[model samples]
Target chain A: MSTLKIEDYDRLRSKLPNRTGGWVPGTAVYCRGYDMMDDLVGRVDFFQSLVLNITGQLPEERFAKWLHAAHICVSWPDPRIWCNQIGAYAAMARATVNAASSFGNLAADSVMYGQGTLPIGTRLIQRLHTQHLNEKKSVEEIVDQEIERKGGKVNIMGFARPLASGDERVVAMRRTAKNLAYQDGAHMQLALAIEELLYNRYSETMNFTGYLCAFMSDLGYSAEQVHRIFALIVVNGVTASFSEEAEKPVDSFLPLRCEDIEYTGPAKRALPDMTDE
Target chain B: MVNRSVKSRKEPFVKKASTNIWQEQPVEHNPYLVEKTHLRGYDFDELTQHCDFTEMFYLLFLGELPNRNQKQLLQLLLVTFISPSPRHPASRSAMSLGGGKTFPQHILPASLGIAGGEYLGGRQVQLCMQLIQDNHQIIPALWLEEQEARLAEADKALLAEGRIIYGFGQQYGEIDPYASLLADKFLGKSFSGPHLTWCAGLVEELKPYCIGWLQTGIVAAVLCDLGFPPHAGAGLFQLIQAPGLLAHGLEAYPKSRTEFPFVRDEDYDIVDT
Candidate 1:
């Protein structure tokens, strides 16, 4: 028998319970205990406000600047990328800007890349950091174990890029972090060590996921928190692609000939007479 | 300078995407135009002339026309879940979107997303199908006993907070009456297969705990009987419920924004952290 009483659910029948803040008419709006109108508006940067909403704690200005750079690093205005391509297609079909942006953002919630990889990547780096520092495991052993876990494939989530190896974003972000006076924490050091080993042995290096996971993990963010923070990382790129295509003629993004689609199904055949009539 | 040079891995991608589900014959004069089409070997014109919508739909998915029993079962299932209740979150989302004057085309996708959620939706159906596929060999009563043991070890407060076993569970602290009735309706049909029968027996074992067939469970069982794999079950649930979602959305599309209740500020409580 369920211990739950009907009244437990009854209490919520006509009410909305929110931990986050809401607006009180004629008073003020609160967001995570900070008054939005008084404390946040025109005071904090967008990233600080975003981080506060996601993590329930306002981040430092330096961290917000670092995140701003990270956002720029990810949101390249190239429609050749999958999520941006969706935005281009949505524009070609004359979808509204919000529709194009939203649909493309949804597409980026993918296992192959973008925000979808953050949780897995963050968890992996955190776990490996613990093993290397606390458990005194060598970087070589950690790499071997991870590769073995992936069925002897060199397909660790953070360490490898999809199209091209060695991520340019990582180098750019490294420069950004240094300029912001951030030091290599233990997690970042462990990531660097793993990248060095992987590069020497397999000719593969850490990607942007690797760099972001390590940096965020060092700053004490959980996998879920990091994933939530970067949920709309590709929005700017998607919007840019959408605007360019939406400005042009309809269905002109990549007009495909009917012959462009290759059909390998059975040759022309007659349908059997319908017996179910 | 950054030492790493970004180079293409040169993965061999197909020049033209290929599809076995559809074949469109190009016009002789212009390859850019299509002259004929076939779906899984059945000519489009012939199918349109001879088959009913249900038959054509079955052929589209299962690659062949369904028999009379299969057709009847599928049609019955479709009508049974024609529209979720107005109180359902997906329906509410659709109504809300329509009331908000969102793009008419965006309504279906948004509502379908809610319908594909983990609670009482496509994700639950997918998980239930997986559970059935993975554990159908075990006796139903034994499986219930195992679940009972697992629940006993779990945090009591958490378990009481609606940690359901995918397809079978109580809604509002009681067995969902409509779900129970629908289960019986499907079980009485001629085309109900082993999967449905097995799930019915499981529902019997669940009665003592106030747990029974959920709508997702019924959908999962029927899709399993229809020979769809577990991964396809979620999308199938979304597709089956699309018409109802779209209907509710379109129905509210012309209504004023105030037509739907907006939960007054007094009704909303914000608890400080």
Candidate 2:
């Protein structure tokens, strides 16, 4: 394998045209919508290559396949709740099957809000809405009255809108999305998928994991799929850097290069660095 | 302690319900709150360090610490992803709306389009970043003043065009209570430099304009502190609305084979003529 030195990485990044109209390399790609996959043809398994290229670590075939499936599935359908879009549903189903085949844990609990609680909550809220209308009270007035009656803080206002006329479909959708956002592994995959989707849709980029859940939920993707996809992406993308010279370029240099590389390790590493404090 | 307080407050709501319907219903849980006991034999000490906001952000979603290279890659990814694009679809949407001509109608869609396009969590962060970069201590004041001024300008433009103000009246009959709390959270404590003073001034200037919309004041103040730039405010709004969107998405997902049937609406009829 052609090892990429730190200097080489730096040179490539610096030489790349600033397509994003900003000084930042990443911003350039984001603004220009430069599809990385297209540039690296015959590398359809971009996720695997990305793991290797960026971290110098290769993933197992099974792991790579699972990751790819998750990626494609999560990436297919952009989340739109009110519109009831279903293009991504097939992808999600395929991802679930791939995950089950690759990982023994197929029936992992969804990270979203408990499926059991959503229906009742929505129904109850709907009932309250109806009661308010019956009493000739506005949605806000009813919520306030209820808060007062319940002696609650009433701090978070505007929860009494009758936006979903007790429609079982809408209620169910809301519940599933909420649950998916909170689900583990699945949430991760979903987040990654959304990240890709957003990049594709908006032609803007952002931190991958930081806003994964936020992005998935915001774009109207299936939260359950997001949770699962996030988990798979994080696990599949894991890599290690055996060198300590990583910080030298980013901190002091104007830009990083491949020649500056000096890390070597087979030691396993995680996806996020969590030792700041 | 905070959790306990919140739980105690919710007890009444739980009790008031005639039955345990709420408990029986599916409830979404925070994934981060993992059960310590379930993590047996896992060497958490071996995990990588999470040092900065970016690192913490990754851990929060990915559930594991990243190594040096991974961290760098993630950073590169973020820098590539988060920055605004000049020719973004949202920007196009905004441009098509005709700046200042349509006012709220134009601005809201444009902002939403920008936000939706970028997937930004909130415009507040972008605004805060801008203020901090421009003039630290005066950020708050400047933010308040600018927002109010923009709002007034928008309102005036709307009036001239014979259109009603957007996001002005309370749709739910009351102001958003969280607005003040959020403002205090973002700026009330963390801000102390020249930006803080500026924010105070802006608040004073804006108070008159926010006659009935008290929440606007809080939103402006908080967004200022959060580092969002004026152009990015609409994006921030979209970002904050992510949770709501996610909730809707999850609810729509089919839980089982049986749930799929619910998706079929029986109301529609096809004409074969």
For each candidate in turn, give its C-alpha RMSD to the true structure in angstroms.
2.7, 30.5
Candidate 2 Cα outliers beyond 4 Å, as residue runs: A1-277, B1-55, B58-153, B156-175, B187-201, B211-244, B252-273
- What value does the lDDT take at residue A122 in candidate 2? 32
Error of 1 at A117 (Å): 1.5
DockQ of the two-chain complex in candidate 2: 0.02
Q: In model 2 chain B, which range of ten residues has the least summed lDDT? A: B1-10
Model 1 chain A weakest lDDT span, ten residues long: A268-277
lDDT (10s digit) by residue, model 1, range A77-179: 9998999998999999888888889889888887799888999999999999999989999999999999999899998878878888778899899999999
Q: Write the per-residue lDDT of candidate 1 for residues B1-273, one digit (tens) a residue.
A: 124668889999888988777887789998767898889888898888988878888888888778888898888878888788888899999998898898899999999989987777898899889888888889999987888878667654333222356788777667889988888888966788888998999989877766778899999999888888999988889888989999999999999988877878899898889
| lDDT of all predictions | 0.86, 0.34
Off by over 4 Å in 1: A1-4, A130-138, B1-4, B142-150, B155-164, B206-210
Give the worst 10-residue stretch by lDDT in candidate 2 chain A. Answer: A236-245
